[model samples]
Target: MSIKPSRGKPLDVGAIGLGPDALPAMADTAAQSRFDFRAWWPEDRRELPYELEIGSGKGTFLVQQAQQMPDTNYLGIEYAGQFARYAADRLRRHNLNNVRMLAYDAAVFVEWFCPDASFRQVHIYFPDPWPKARHHKRRLIQTPLLRQLHRVLTPNGFVRIVTDHDDYYAWIEDHVAQVTDLFERQPFERPIGAGEGEVVGTNFERKYRREGRPFNALSLRKL
Candidate 1:
């Protein structure tokens, strides 16, 4: 069924070749403008607790989680259009109806559309460092985003992050530090059923592990 939310306009996901009707696993872009979880999610699953994943590349983490936790619903927002389509297709192929993927900028979606205290957890793994000093502003982990994250998450909801770049990890800590009153630092636990030496167990984590790259991670619970 095509979703046409009464409030807010559609997000410009930019040139997605396939329309919503053609892809049941993909979220309706119009739902991005002003997301109402109860209206956008499947009717039967609307009451289920949700988890948001930003940058769910190839749907690896979500596919695993949706399989393991059938009671939870997942929404993944990926800026890269191709990756979004691929991830949605993967979910469809696996017959996982509890998860959906959208091709849109997660930052804007979170700040503008997500409802307050709506999610149980938010996952962000291996986001681009935008390593150059000049491009650091483009990085996803920043003050404004953190504030939005805190607002959107349920009280005591957790944000789990993993990164392979030491500099970026330091950058994350610095930004998160500014919001200490809103979020308390907690130990980063490896996801359930993750293999030994794997954190988050996403495709990027596996690839980076094989390359012998060091990893740093943190968890923050909304205060």
Candidate 2:
């Protein structure tokens, strides 16, 4: 069952050997665009960098990445069903092949979804900062989770993170510095995607832009 949506012409990810059929796990969603198919993996092939984008709040970045990098399979995990469905629907509309979505909690499948040191790149863009000291523990890039990310990522593989909170950024720099001698931090601006003059206009990026906030992008790799 092929998915054909109303808007955004379906892309031919299958033609370039980047389509869904090759990833049998996607066969379950052949009918429903937003179906859950986590139980379909075999023993050996369960963990492939097949890619992981955590905290996929909305379809903006994940959807765009999926469409652009059809050759590199991608997965998006968002807790919000509306966003998940919208992204799935959008991906289906694009007729993209190398992308699949999951509407589950990230912590639940972090280990089971893939094997140790499998992903080459893990993205966590604009995760909640929990600015208040009282709520700081809620921030995503803490010691345990950071170490977990480090464990699951291949050596030299990167965990790309972005945020608009200055305090949070500084906190991560301090904490990660204590992790191991291999991590490097080069604080970046304007993000990797938005070109000059192109509006920094995702739902959150736009909010930051309107408030005169500068975005911080960093990549941490285990070496």
Candidate 3:
């Protein structure tokens, strides 16, 4: 179930016309409710391998991956409501049932909804750098969150991350190295045709490429 922030009460799913094809919006106010994957997803998908993407903007990467790997279930968590809604609509229009979107805090969703050894892979592309020294604490690739991610991933599961900010990439590497027992850095091989002006994983990646910026891609395997 996708959770969206609500002012007071949760929006009625029926009134919103969010059919099964569209990502359902659970009320942000309903944090007390536990998320059961077996109950949330279609009965047939309960046994499928699952993957997750954090900060999936506009659903470009999520849609492409889901279409390429129809047997794998994909879930995307986006903080922006507009992007989440747009992505959901796009998925619905394409009639893709393997992808879902949530418009809620990624950290909260991971902590509350994700189960142990649940995901086969997790992707985080172009997360906010939070360049300012004072805002460094807000960056997503911190030790605590990495620990949570480690717990949710299956044994030998992988986390793929990409960033255009050199400093942020260094920071992420440093933090990830601190948790050596749970994760190990793995070499990432960029696709043969991936370069400037080429569409990579996410929309932001393309934009950055168009701006002549280089990206650093990292992969870590859960131990």
Best by lDDT: 1
TM accuracy, model 1: 0.84
Candidate 1 stretches greater than 4 Å from native: 1-33
- State the lDDT of candidate 3 residue by residue for 83-187, as single tens digits: 777677677656778777777777877766656787998889899999999999999999989998998898999988999999999999899889999998888
Residue range 1-223, candidate 2, lDDT tens digits:
1233335554322221112222334233323322223233333434444667777665566556666565566777766655555566666657765666666655545633444665677777777889899998877777766766776677787777778889999988877877776566644333343534433234577667778888777877677
* lDDT computed for candidate 3: 0.75
Error of 3 at 50 (Å): 0.3
TM-score of each: 0.84, 0.71, 0.82
Query: Where does model 2 exceed 4 Å of error?
Result: 1-49, 186-202
Ranking by lDDT: 1, 3, 2
Q: RMSD (Cα, Å) of candidate 2?
A: 8.5
Query: Whole-model Cα lDDT per candidate?
Result: 0.79, 0.61, 0.75
Candidate 1 per-residue lDDT over residues 70-125, each given as its tens digit:
88888888877767776776677677777878777888778766778989999999
TM-score of 3: 0.82
